[model samples]
Target chain A: MSAKGVLVRVSTYAALIVMALATLFPLLWVTSIAFMRAPERFAGTPPLWPDHPTLVNMVNIVHQQRIGYYFLNSLIVAAATTPLSVLVAGLAGYALAQAKFRAHRLVSWIVMFAVLVPNQALVLPLFEMFSAVHLINHYAALILPAAANAVSIVLIQAYARGIPADVLDAARIDGASEWRTFFSVVVPLMAPMLAAVAVLTFVVSWNDFMWPMIAMQKVDMQTLPVALASIDREHYQNIGLMAAGATVAILPMMFVFLASQRYYLRAVSAGSLTD
Target chain B: MARLELQRVSKLLANRQVVLQDIDCTVNDGELISVVGPSGCGKSTLLRCVAGLDKITSGDIRIGGQRVNDLPPQQRNVAMVFQNHALYPHMTVYQNLAFGLRVRRVARAIVDARVRRTAVRLGLEALLGRYPRELSGGQRQRTALGRAMLREPGVFLLDEPLSSLDIPLRAEMRRELSALHTALGTTMVYVTHDQSEALSLGQRVVVLADGQIQQIDTPDGIYKEPSNRFVAGFVGWPPMNFLDGDWLENSGLDAHCIDYGIRPERLLLQPSSSADAFIAGRLERIESFGGEWQVEISRNGSRVIARVAPNPELRRDNELRLWFRREDLYAFDRATGRRLQG
Candidate 1:
């Protein structure tokens, strides 16, 4: 090959290697900090590798910090939020995409506007509403608000747009009722997009720091990120334990994302590009 | 067997533009009719209206002599094959074909028998276990056809079902579709923008332009006796050429008509003659197309084309006189763009 071609090829590989390192560095550093013996983690110059790796920090986070209960709480909130939001948003998306109503355009614009409004602005009013209902510390406070997500609805709407209009028309002609058409035809067609929305919503609910930090005040009911922050507050110098808790919080999201990476990527791209 | 009719159907878009207006055509019992038109001419909209997918703005659609305008698609007993072959991507070919039947609560035995029969007929027996993505474009189209066929509805609606296939595959599936129509003898309304497919598969062709029916006739009649300039231009490849020349002399030869039309095949390259309408021109280009040569000639600032046998002696800028028999010429109303019938 020509010298120019060889140089281009080498540069491409070098860039990819740089990118790979940039991505892997944080995860590796966090994991290393999580396993380091406290002495090594607190050393003036933190060593890349622990002289002796230990499980003490992990066990301490689980037992002493009550990380198991927080982990369970995060799981419950995320699990509840993901499926409910995906289902509701998926139905709304299908309706907006296929069904004709007088207010269709109006509803779509409204949803778009809602997506632009950050959740931070809604926290005060949402907290006030939950307090009046006496469900401020309950799981409903998180799950209910997360269930009607505008971004997920828009993602599903955009994905469903690519499904040829003929298919939906065919389903209508085939005697499938509206709900049956949704569950049978639209849902099956939407599996890839739904998997993506599920992962995203689950990640959002699991890693929600600000809202859960405010609503889940009680220690027993605190979600993982909130409880992790509390642990960090009390053990400011216990870098090992805090790192272990952060890793525990990050692992499930990693699994969920990696497991459905193809679908997640497709949905993200489709949402941004397609009509 | 069922007959389908559209009665002055019209579609007004959200912008309130009349997309389709006064579309009236009928598919008699067991007959296949193709609606041929240019893109965006609303042929698909008419099909959707008939399939109960779109609502008619001011008219009614009748299937089997019963009004279906107010009915839902499911209640209207129509099955459709989409342009993209809309086979459910997630399902195996067998399940894709079985979907409509299962939705209707068809007995397992009956659905199996019908699907098996359709698979064998479409030569898709081997591919039934595969997903739509695994099948070739032709196979996916057949599977879509099979899905509609299994429903066995009163009328079959196909919206450019073969448009997605490659040219060779489209030709093969066209033959298969015609044969299937013959065997089943179902009322079918096929829509396409391709004139050849419409000409070959449909027993009758409805030529539409700008949502209005230009002519409804057999293939031969439509090609030979197009109702207007739009039909003439829209229905043929290398479309019929038009020249806006006034009639110079009208005499005892009964040649009073003007605005003449002739297909490229109707123009003959002959020795010069003293004929009043004989056009003399300089050959601008010659294209040898295997079976024949398509020659373009310029005359009096107008261009005309003639398909002739490959004449190796013919050179560029060669002078030639092309003439058409008066009987072969079509006269159109200059103002109205409609054919002037003798």
Candidate 2:
């Protein structure tokens, strides 16, 4: 290889490393502090790594605040939301992309417009509708509204368009019913996008703070993030304890993302249909 | 296996656009019929209607002497080969070939036997484990054909199935398709915009334009006697030359009531002076297409093109005179565009 080419390659790796560190530093620091002794956390010119590691903060947070229960609540919400939303969005996206209808363009426009609407703006209406249905403080309050996600639909619709109408039509002519075609043909072909959307839905549902806080007013019904904030109000001075709580809270999503990382990459560089 | 018939079949989109209107045609049992038209002449739509992929706005379609308008595509027992060869990317060749019967819950042993038998017939046995992405274009095309062939439907609908292949591959597939048609003896409808493809492959050609069928005849009949002006203009290489019928006015004929066309091959450059008539114009340009040269001539703002033997003496901007017998020109009604019988 030429000297110039080697230099370009070296510099590209350098830039990527810098960006990677920038992205990972916050999460790494929180994890590091979670294992640090309390005195080291308050020490002057705080060290990046824990000088003497310990699990006191983890035990304290779990024992004192019932973090496990709140974590379970968050998991339940995510578990319900991800599969339901993916299925709904998958069907809707497939229809919007392939099915011909009188209002096809109109329905497509509505989906695009819905993506632009802020989630904060819908809280009031969503709350009122849920309240009317007597679902406040219920897990359904979180799972129901999210099941019909617009952004996921748009993501899926963009991917689904790449699935040629010929494939769908061929299936129909081959004796597959509409629903069977979707499951046997479209679903398998769209696996990468569905996996990516599943991860995104899980992360968003697990980490959501604003609506869950307002809806789950009962202390025991509160999700992890809401319960963590309540703990944060009184224990603002305990940085190690807060770090421990944050670290535990971040673990589930980390695992979810890591498990789905390969499919996520495929979704990003989507040439699944060709391969 | 079955005769297919369309009686006054019409398709109108929800946007109130008429895609096809009053299309009346039929395919005898075990016939290979081609529907030829321009790109938007609704030829694909016509094929789709027969396959039940698209519903007709009105009229009855019969297969095997049974009304099939209300039957779904699967229940209708019709198979289609799309222009793009729509093999499932996620499925292997074996799965693709077996999909039709598998969906209907056919016996597993029978499905395997049929898929294996077809793979051998199409020379695709070794590639049965491979996905579509791993196959070459011709291999993919064969897989698509195999998928449809395995269905063994009463009627086969092919929408320009070879349109995506290269020239050599297209000709090769065309020959294979004819042999397969003959062997199966199944009624087949092939839709294509390529007129020559229609003529060469079809036992009968159905010409269409402006959302309606123009003419349906044998290849020889269509080329020899086009039913109207559109068929004449659309179904020929280098096209027929249309001249203003008024050019015959000086010959004691009332030309304003008719339009006229002459095939380029019929015009003689150095004719006997005793010919019935002549068209004189300036040779605007000459294009050599290997075996022959097509020369365009303009006369009083009207253009006339003629295909002639490659002549070394033809030059641009020169005066060119071509003579034709009066009987050689095909005449059409001026307003309705219908052929005016001699």
lDDT of each: 0.85, 0.91
Best of the candidates, lDDT: 2
lDDT of 1 by residue, B1-342 (tens): 699988888889878998799988888999999999989999998888888888889877899999988999999989999998777667799998998888889999999999999999889999999998788888888888999988888899999998888899888889989989999999999999999899988899999888889999999999988988778877876778675542223322333444666778877776335333455579999988999999998866788888888878888998976666666677777677888887
TM-score of candidate 2's A chain against the true A chain: 0.97
Instruction: Give the per-residue lDDT of model 1 (tens digit) for A74-112.
Output: 999999999999999999988888777999999999999
In the order shown, the candidates' Cα RMSDs to the true structure are 4.0, 3.2
**Stretches of candidate 1 exceeding 4 Å from the true structure:** A1-64, A94-106, A233-244, A265-275, B228-243, B246-257, B263-298, B306-325
Evaluate model 1 with DockQ and give the value.
0.42
Cα lDDT for residue A3, candidate 1: 100
Q: List the residue pairs that clash in candidate 2.
A: none
The DockQ score of candidate 2 comes to 0.67
DockQ of each: 0.42, 0.67
Error of 1 at A65 (Å): 4.0
